[model samples]
Target: MRSPSIAAAASTAVLMTLASASRGQTTGGFSLDRFEPAPAGDAFFGVPSPAAPGHLAPRVHAMLDYAHRPIHSSGDSPIDLVSSQALLRLGASLALWDRLLLSLDAPLAVAQGGDDPGIPGVAFTELTAPELGDLRFGARLRVLGRDAGPLQLGIGGYLFAPTGTPAQYTGDEEPRGAFHASLGGRLGTARSSLGFLWSASGGVELGGGPNRPQQLTFGAAAGALLGGDLLQLGAEAYGAAPLGGDLLLSSTPVQREEAGLNAELLLGAKLRVLGGLTFGAAVGPGLTNAIGTPSVRAVGMIGWAPLPQPDSAERAPAVAAGDKDDDGIDDALDACPDVKGDPSPDPAMDGCPPADRDGDTVRDIDDACPTTPGARSADVTRSGCPDDRDGDGFHDGIDACLDVPGSSSDDPRKVGCPADADDDGIVDASDACPKVKGTASRDPKQNGCPDDPDGDGVRGAADACPNERGRPDPDPAQNGCPRFVRVHADEITTSKPVQFIVYGKTRAQTVAPISDDLLREVRDAIQQNPDIELVEVQGHTDDSGSEEYNLRLSQERAEAVLSWLVAAGVPREKLVARGYGFERPLGDNRVKTGRQKNRRVQFMIIKRKGAAVQR
Candidate 1:
């Protein structure tokens, strides 16, 4: 259902004219094309807004559209019962004082087609099909609102002359008039900023006859411009309901509903280009299968007007200004063209000044800190001027985010805001790892950083002992971990042996007479592990002692150790004293080293709070 041949439509029209002559009176309905070109200043597609686009001058426009199968049938006899034609609409309008607008529009069918010689739709058009449509004389007046807003109103009227061929489905058989009012609104100037335009029109078509029906026409359109002002997208819906007997079934072979009622919704896209030129296209479904309503329709439009160019004020050929010395002054005016200089009031010194190579205000000849920028100071060694500490162009006095260097910005509030390369919201100024995306933290060194894997609270690249969990320490080697103490599953082990005093004839030993830091570590280990319900203090003696005396001496030494631990904050109930003289030794007692090892004390974990502790 696209274009139908002209020969088919022309032959159909001829047959229709002969059939109409036989019937005599104007047949029932199904004639005129329902589509109309929207006038200039249209807010969205076809809906007219209150604004007068050409209020200061006359504006002329032309629009072309191809309507597909405007009059079609679901019955397979003829896919398209009426013509699918192309219309070229030409219109001109003049708005007076921004309120009144008068327009003239002429529409012609450049190409058209309909059903073959004998379709039911052809009989309904009781006249010869013509290539022209009704000529429109239109006028409108804005009755309310001075500017485009939510509640602006415009009232208008249209007079259509009988310049069309009903047989061709382009217009009515007689003159018609319509009165309409439109309500509209326009917000913002750009679609990206949520700018939009909308309007709706309601009107009555008057004066009806057998071939033409009085009608109620209503429509609304909404649109927005995107891509700056280059693209516009919009949708429009308009429908007309035939009044009086037009809705009644006529005595015809057309299957009763011969009257035409127009209702179609269209979606359109428009492109604005080349200053004042606009090109657009649209397509949508016909809501109902009325006589002139199609199953679907498509439209394209283009408009143009004179471009309002900006008034030229300073239009001269682009020529680079001469500045040989690369200073602020031109070569013609520079006293020393080859050298850069500061501006001076005296002509002889215009481009020459004591060279401040670093561009500091202080002249190089009197500059105390020539390489380092410093302001003039009372002291001779340093000028009175301020110094640039961070060297971020701005002196420390004005470097707002002073911790990190930043670039200057056109925005006054963010004069030297730093960049956030990772886009993590933390600027490089305070971000410890600025190049990588991370979260913020309380630690300044770890701010905008990744997780601390060792659970030591140390983060980023600053952690020296990253693989091993340790506390923060000034000495990198120790890393806050002790050198000697290690808690094992069954006991506390130390790199150094515990020291004690040995006295008496039986070789009795007491911890009170000697002290070692490893002893304190053992006490701390037992205290730290509250789950160890009981720890046995074992004392052993070398083979040199007589069995009975050695056992007694060992028991005495074990008991003494328990008493010493209880005094050092180990619970008395958590300790059990026992002696096994020489029963278990780390080395044989035959050698001197073995004898010393055999006389040493060892603690054993006997019972834990819940389960046996695992190493």
Candidate 2:
């Protein structure tokens, strides 16, 4: 099944091929095998692992490889494109120092067979004899990392020479080369039970001439060492495409695989029969019908590969590392870097082993009350102690409320003591008016419950003067009030200061007539409240005077006021006077303002409506 038009075109192509071959030249295309193998560790049949086992010393390598039908075609009837070919390759590699590797290989096509159509201009185009392929030499240099480490990088290139027969389709006519960047890494070690490595390369293949297209070449390989380092298995893929030129990763390489992926895949196994002597075989198929990509391929290889001795890093460290804790584990891996203890995985406790003496989860180092079991807390001081929010003697659990101090109670259920809702001494449990702050009372029923927050004994809301001390008054309008020494209130609530003029120096300081008006107001207020109980005229002085002089001076002032009240028809038996030498100051006596308030006479009502309410 051959069309005349296609056969004519094929004949023209053949004539051109013959014309080129006669001059000992080729179209510089269709050379199949691309060999670039790493010099050390494990290697695949074609593309190699980018690893060099050891580089301390120079290492030499040799290989003999045979491939079946690595370059062939199909379905071209009378003009039968070659169906099979046998190839033999001999190669060698040498690695220098820990960086550079050099290699060379020469291949021979032993036999190639295909059909020939009797078309004009193409009569002698069929292949029948053995031929030689191009000669290849290559070199690579380490760019980063230790050659054998898990992340080494390298860059290299291969040079091709026109050393084979042009008729066999195995060589490029013009000198050419390919350059690439390679990356990969190896894990474990040759001495270890297991070792693995991987490599990938990408670069450009130089074109020989106008007829030969420059291609983007790529390869990937992975290999492993097993059977205690005696056996190796690997797989690899290598390809080239002019259409994929340069942008291999950014472009749709996946689409190339679906459409025209020109690559061959190989899987092989190698075994070391003797020291440095490895024998291997591989088989695979081409992914697309590009030049040199065969329908099916098989390869066999025999080689001597020896690894170099590892460097000092593979041995014990030269110097002693710091270990302040004296733990067997190195400080680097220790959870508690400075603490002498076991290792831990947590960074907070790493190297420092977890320890809690009291069996609480809280670490002893951070626990405040180390001996006692406690809850976790933001406060380092009490982290390990029972929760005490308000700082009361009772634990938070027994305390009815948190963040509020409570009193100690006889009741077990109320161990937190008195849970005073208000800041008064009386516990809210006993205080009927819990919200009202008040003083303690002898009678529980009439205690803080009645809301005598001022404790002046004016129970309920009737006491116009709440906080200050007060007494029951005979005046209905101002009953249970404290403040203003006025007749309207019937009690000495407050008034202008009682001014006095003292004349007697040696004779018990006489009260002058200068404070007469102020004294009369006090007398009038007391007279208006006949039902009022005993009233105590308290005198006080600032700290400016000596204690003895202030007491004597204040006593005279209080007695002066008291005598005025008794003279104004007030019962003398119902009144008493006392002088306190700056002892119960209503304000700080250090300042002039406070001293002014201190040097004053106070009419204190020793009176209360509630029998239990006390000053």
TM-score of each: 0.46, 0.44
Q: Which candidate should be chosen as best, given TM-score against the real structure? A: 1
Worst 10 residues of 2 by lDDT: 247-256
lDDT, candidate 1, at 607: 77
Best by lDDT: 1
lDDT (0-100) at residue 612 of candidate 1? 59
Per-residue alpha-carbon lDDT of model 2 for 485-528, expressed as tens digits? 53322236456676664334432234555656556656655654
Q: What tens-digit string does per-residue lDDT give for candidate 1 at 1-615?
A: 112342233233322222343356554333345676677535455666665543565766677767677655442234454557677788777777868888888988777665544636434443232377888999988889755445689999999887776555566667889889988876553323345778889999886345566888899998885654567688999988777444211333322333445788889987777775777788888887665666667677677643322112213233345778776666766788777765576878787756775566777656665555667766665562355556666555455666566777554444445877556899877877664467898888778766654456655645543323446777754443334555556875556555555432332235634444556666876876678888888888888758888888788888877877887788889999999987787865544567777886778887789875554
Off by over 4 Å in 1: 1-18, 22-31, 76-79, 117-130, 190-193, 247-261, 305-615
Cα-based lDDT at residue 246, candidate 2: 19
**Runs off by more than 4 Å, candidate 2:** 1-42, 53-79, 126-129, 243-261, 308-615
lDDT of 2 at 304: 75
The TM-score measured for candidate 1 stands at 0.46
Computed on alpha carbons, the lDDT of every model, listed in order, comes to 0.64, 0.61
